[model samples]
Target: MIKVGVVGGTGYTGVELLRLLALHPGVQLEAVTSRGEAGTPVADLFPNLRGHVDLDFSEPDPERLAACELVFFATPNGIAMKMTESLLNAGVKVIDLAADFRLKDPALWEAWYGMPHACPGLLEEAVYGLPEVNRKSIADARLVANPGCYPTAVQLGFMPLLEYEGIDLSCLIADCKSGVSGAGRKAAVGTLLAETSESFKAYGVPGHRHLPEIRQGLETVSGQQVGLTFVPHLTPMIRGIHATLYLQLDDPDLDLQSLFEARYRDEPFVDVLPAGSHPETRSVKGANHCRLAVHRAPASNVVVVLSVIDNLVKGAAGQALQNMNIMFGLDEAAGLRGIALLP
Candidate 1:
């Protein structure tokens, strides 16, 4: 079993990572760090992992973390970059589930995230951890920058279009909605139940931090400059992301359904639904799956694609585990085969 440690274990994504790694057959759980909650039983805070995980929230001791073969940083942005270089030098692989190393340009990252990057040189070395696009690179990467939740949903919905011809790449629009949990477990009046529940409103239309990340990924995939309007909404729900992508196409005979299916045919986590089907976020809740469906507007040149994923699963923690499995040459789906939770 590979030894692993988690840097932050108090937030939503942190607990989700702990939940998966605890029961993983190939993982030997090590230290879980929380400066605020140090010495607290892991199960006491999560409850779901009461019987599975036996560790406690300890201070982030670099020496203990170095003993593990791999470490995951579930801390907020600006936390991982401060310590990743030391862990890498200690011969430990690091996967950051935050925005610390996701953007290649340190300037852009600083502008978006509101902080100057501590380790600008490592930006080029950190591989963007989207298994579908960087499977080969992730296997050999010592540092990985996990994709953001909205970017994961939007990018997956738009990927197949980039592969085919005759689709307008200039006017892409992603109308994505995410649950309140996407706001993180931190206490905030904006995400309180009284404010979010029984309401629906778009928050980051003009500029969201994920906008540049999504554009960068799409441009990398298409090998050309991409013009995109990515608007993210805060939904009342607590666990899913639904991305409705719009595109313009002149090819009347193009088989979008077949194209999506063919693109994701070999992918284990992307489920391309049948033609005319609309994927639901609940269908992928608690599973590391992106369920997608494609369609053409009747008598119009507009093409629409719907993508759904559990915000905390495929969107964050579950995808992090998927990357770790690949990095270790283990089964790609190891410890990630759980069925989606349903009502």
Candidate 2:
């Protein structure tokens, strides 16, 4: 069994890691870290996980985490970089769910994240962990950078088209909507129920932090520079993400339906719905599945792709666990085989 450790265990993503790992047959959770909640019982804090994980939260310590075979960093953007190098030296595989190591360029990363990278040298060593696209790299990597919520949905939706020749890459637009939980468990005025509920508005119109990450992912697939106009909206729901992608087809002969079918034929979690079908976020809630639907608007050269995932599952914690399974040579769907929770 792979002894697992999680740093920052009190937030949405942290608890999510615990929830999923608790049922993972190959994982034995060793430690969970929380500065303020140190010495608190994990079950007492999260009643939902009462009988699942029976461990106490402790303060973050690199030495304590080094003992585990694998460690997941579910902390904020800058926290993972502080300890990844030491953990790697200790021969512990690392999967980070933060934005610290996602981007390849430190300048662009720093410019958007508002601080210089703490460890730029590690950038080239960290593999982008999107199982469907970068599985081979993740399997061989010691350090995996799990993607952001928005980037995961957007990249998966457009990857099939972007990699194929004769697909117009110049005019691509991703209009995404995410739940308030995507903002994190931190208290913020913008996420307050009074402010978010009954109101749907877009934040980060053209320059959200997830933009560069999404662009980086698509570019890697296309083998060239890929640019996009991404807009993220805040919905009042608690946990889910819906991304509608618009792309232009350069080749008139390209069949949008067959293209997606042939591309994701072997993928486990990516489900391509029938043509003209629309997917709802709730359809993939609480599961590590991404439901997709493709459409070609006749006479307009426009093809639309719809993608949906639970923000905390496929978008964050679940994806991190997926990377851990790859690094350990376990089945990619080990602890994530459940269906989405629907109302």
Candidate 3:
């Protein structure tokens, strides 16, 4: 069994990680850390995990975490970088579910995250953990930087198109909406039921943090920089992300449906729906899956792709487990086979 430890076990992503890890047959839950909730039984805090998780929340201790074969940092961005070096030196593979190691350039990371990277040297070595794009690298990586929720949805939606040469690289647009839980488990006025419910609005229009990460990933795939307008909205729901991606097709004859189908045919988590299908966010809720559909207007060169995923699952915890499976050489679908929850 792969001995594992999780830091920051109180937030949405943290608890989601615990929920999935509790049932992962290949994983042995070693420790879960929450500074404020230390000594509190994890199940007491999250009743959904009552029967499955019996471990108490512990404080973040480097030595204890280093003892585990792999440690997942589900904490806020700055926390992981501070301790990752020590853990890695102690022979522990680290997976950060935050933005700490996502950007390769320290200056760009500092510009957006507003802090100097704790371990900038390791950025080159930290493989971006998108199995569809970096599967081979993840398998050999000692450190993995898991992609953000929005980036995951947007990138996967545009990937197949960017791989070929027909689409206009510039002027890409990602109009994405996410549920309130995507803000993390927090007591924010904006995310309150009375505020978010019965309303819809966009934030970070000027420049969202995920913009650079998404651009970086797309550029890597297309072999050129892209002009992208990424706008994120907050929906009243609890979990999921819906990304409506717009791209101008230079070659109108490109078989988009065949392209997407062939691109994700062997991928375990990405589902390419039939042509003319519009995927719903609920279809991927509570599951680590990205459902996609490609469409085009009548006699138009504009191609539209709809992608949906559960922000906390495929966006965060479930993807982390998938990376763990790859790093440890286990079946990628071993512990992530849960179907989406329905009404």
Candidate 4:
């Protein structure tokens, strides 16, 4: 079993990690830390995990964390960068489920995150943990940066079009909507039930932080500079991300359904639906799967791709577990094969 430690174990992603890890057969959760909730029984704060996880929430102790085989940082952005170096020195693999190591450019990271990077030297060394593109690299790297929810959904939706010919890579758009849980388990006025429910609105239209990460992933996959416009919205639901991608299709002969199927055929977590199928977010709820579908607008050169994933699962904690499995050479689907939670 892989002995693991998790930092920031009270937020949405943090608890979600505990939820998945508690049931993961190969994972032995050594520690789960929460500075404020330290000394509280983890199940006390999260009743859903009452019987499954019996450990108490402990303070963030680097020495104790260093003893684990792998550590997952589900904390806010800056928190992971502060402790990752020390843990690495102790021969523990690190997986950060935040934006700390996602961007390659330090200056860009500072520009978006509004803070100096703690370990700029580790930027190049950190592999982006999107298994579809960086599987081999993640399995070999000591540091893995898990992709954000928006980037995971957008990049996966646009991936097939990027590789195939006749798609206009010059202009792409990802209009995505996410549930309130994507905001974390915080008390934000905008995410309150009174404000979010029965309402739908876009928040980041000019430029969001995930924009750079999404463009970077696409540019890396296609080997060309990509032009993309990303807009994120908040919906009334509790958990999910729905990304509707628009691509300028120049090749009528290109079989998009086949392209998506072929690309994700060997991937256990990505599901490519049948032609004309529209994938719903609930279909992937509480599951570590990205469901995708392709379509062609009548008489228009526009091709649309719909991608759905549970933001907390495939987008955050679930993807972190996927990376851990790859890093430890375990079955990629181990502890991740549970079906989506449906109403």
Count of backbone clashes, every candidate in sequence: 0, 0, 0, 0
Question: Cα deviation in Å at residue 289, candidate 1?
Answer: 0.1
Model 1: pairs clashing at backbone N, Cα or C within 3 Å: none
Candidate 1 lDDT over 1-343, as tens digits, reads 9999999999999999988888799999989999999999999999998988888899999899999999999998999999999999999999999999999999999899999999999999999999999999999999999999999999999998887778888899999999999999988999999999899999887799999999999998988888899899999999999999999997899888888889999999999999889999899999999999998988899999999999899999999999999999999999999999887
lDDT (0 to 1) per candidate: 0.94, 0.92, 0.96, 0.94
The best candidate in terms of lDDT: 3
What is residue 135's positional error in candidate 2, in angstroms? 0.9
Predicted structure 3: lDDT: 0.96
lDDT by residue for model 4 (1-343), tens: 9999999999999999999999999999999999899999999999999999999999988789989999999999899999999999999999999999999999999999999999999999999999999999999999999999999999999998898867788899999999999998998899999998899999988889999999999999999998898999999999999999998988888888899999999999999999999999999999999999999999988999999999999999999999999999999988999998868
Which residue pairs overlap in candidate 4's backbone?
Answer: none
Tell me each candidate's TM-score: 0.99, 0.98, 0.99, 0.99
Lowest lDDT 10-residue stretch of candidate 4: 160-169
Compare candidates 2 and 4 on lDDT and give the better one.
4
Q: Model 3 over residues 1-343: C-alpha lDDT tens digits?
A: 9999999999999999999999999899999999999999999999999999999999998888988999999999899999999999999999999999999999999999999999999999999999999999999999999999999999999999999998899899999999999998999899999999999999999999999999999999999989999999999999999999999999877899999999999999999999999999999999999999999978899999999999999999999999999999999998899999987
lDDT of 2 by residue, 1-343 (tens): 9998999988999888899999999988999999989999999999999999999999987888999999999999999999999999999999999999999999998899999998899999999999998899999999999999999999999998987888777778999999999999998999999999999999898579998899888998998886599999999999999999998887878888898999899988899999899999999989998999998886888888999999999999999989888888999999999888869
